[model samples]
Target: MISAVFWDFGGVFTGSPFHLDDYARSLGTTNERLLEHVFGRYEANGDHPWHRLERGEGTLAEALEAADESCRADGIEGFSAEGFFKAMSGTSSEERRDKVMAKVSELNDAAIRQAIITNNAKEFGDIWRSLIPVDELFEAVIDSSAVGIRKPDSAIYRLALERLEVSRPETSVFLDDFEPNVAAARNLGMHGILVGEDIVPALRELDRILGNDGV
Candidate 1:
């Protein structure tokens, strides 16, 4: 009885938001340190600089400055968002997510509607959009920056379902790499899949949920 499928763009369809390991190595740091300094407690939608950026409250430049400040405070410096994102984006392109793309095709063919809900910065829109055939692959693309509402905040989830005109939230499935986001969706009564480093298991779970009923 699933009516639609909701996807997260970053981890679900493409590589992680950035090239963590490479970027970290370039800075003579560990991936964990880089993520902590840059992203800062991502599981929660807090007052962190990156969180504020995704919520459209600040510019990418401001967020990077915050990262640099935090690094300098800890006596660890030389973290530049511009440089890191540039290097990371260099590796991004279409076909990076063929498995998910195929499943999306199958769902599209079955007439099961799909949309993308991403916690993203406004500045990243053009870069990421070009990496995916968003218009062709999804009926709706929801970005937190554009909408002024980020994930783990039920308002955005409600907004997406509203746009999709879904009467029963439980009849939709949402997939994301972040557990908190997925958990929030489940709390709102949707079937949620937590995508991990391995994409196949998550896709398998989606297949099991949708079955062959074709909506």
Candidate 2:
């Protein structure tokens, strides 16, 4: 049985911030390449400006400046971090979010542990919280900015498991839109589910994994 459920706030609960791929295409590059320039190789921890912002080591202005410079150097024109963020939707689908919330509530009622592990910025804290009943829904939220570390880094995952008191990593499950983050959790022995553009299928998989199917 799954003892705990870990969630990624951005893509799981809300529309993915990653859909800004249009900007990548506009600059004649794939989203993956542009994202590497912005977010760095997400699988490894590094000093990328965005990474620093998420780690609370730098301000948004600084990160954006550095990222803009990187884009300029790469000839990716008209790079606007502000605009990219604007396209990051807060909620996926109202009904879909409600479904996930209901599941969370059900798990909470059953005494199954829950926590949010999001690679987010300090600047957007209040804004993100306003999108959901975070405190009511989650026992703990490990925001990378607050903790000085981000996902795909083993330390952060370990920290979440520690806080959740999940002694057996295999008994825990992680859900995220980013595959690398999911892979990282899987590497740590937790079951990881990758959420795509549509989250309904992923939700069904979650139920299947927890044996909450057909309920």
Candidate 3:
């Protein structure tokens, strides 16, 4: 039985429509090249600068400096961090899904343990609780920005499990919007659900998987 259920904040619970094509167009770069530049094979090592920015540790200025350094290193010039952030800020949050607190309450009522492991800003979380009792929703919430860490990092996952008091990976399940993030949890021997498509399907899939396990 799954004793603890972990969910990602964006895409999984919220409707964050971040598009790569739009970002590339905004940057005047081809999608393929942008992907190679930002998410090269070294992404697993937390080398993808933008991914870290989304987690909220560094300010936009800091990220821009990093990008400038990277651009100079690649012998490319005129990469504007302002332009990149403008495109990023343009991708609005999704309106279709329910807030995480409501969903967690639903799962808790079903007697399943629930928590949130997301790469969001600490400031946003503070504002989020003003809308709902965030602490009451999940047994734990592991925010990468607040912790100075990001997903695909095993240490953060371990922190979540330890906080939830779940020792075995079999007792927990993690759902994330990104495949690589899901893969990280899987590597840790935890059950993982990739939520790249509609989250309703993923939520239903979770129900089926956990239901079969008698959670």
TM-score of candidate 1 on Cα atoms, chains taken together: 0.89
Best by TM-score: 2
Please give, for residues 147-205, the per-residue lDDT of candidate 3 as tens digits: 76678788888988988888998778998877878888999889998875456667777
Report the C-alpha lDDT of model 1 over 1-215, residue by residue, as the tens digit: 99989999988777666347877787788877777888898877888989999999999988888889887787676777677776666554456488888999989998889999999999889987876689999999889999988998999899999989998999999999888999999999999999876788999898888775445
Whole-structure CA lDDT of model 1: 0.85
Q: What are the TM-scores, per candidate, against the unseen true structure?
A: 0.89, 0.91, 0.75
**Top model number, lDDT:** 2
Worst ten-residue run, lDDT, model 2? 83-92
Clashing pairs in 3: 15-94
lDDT values, one for every candidate: 0.85, 0.86, 0.68
lDDT of 3 at 135: 76
The sequence of per-residue lDDT tens digits that candidate 2 reaches over residues 118-172 is 9999999999899789999999999999999999898999999999999999898
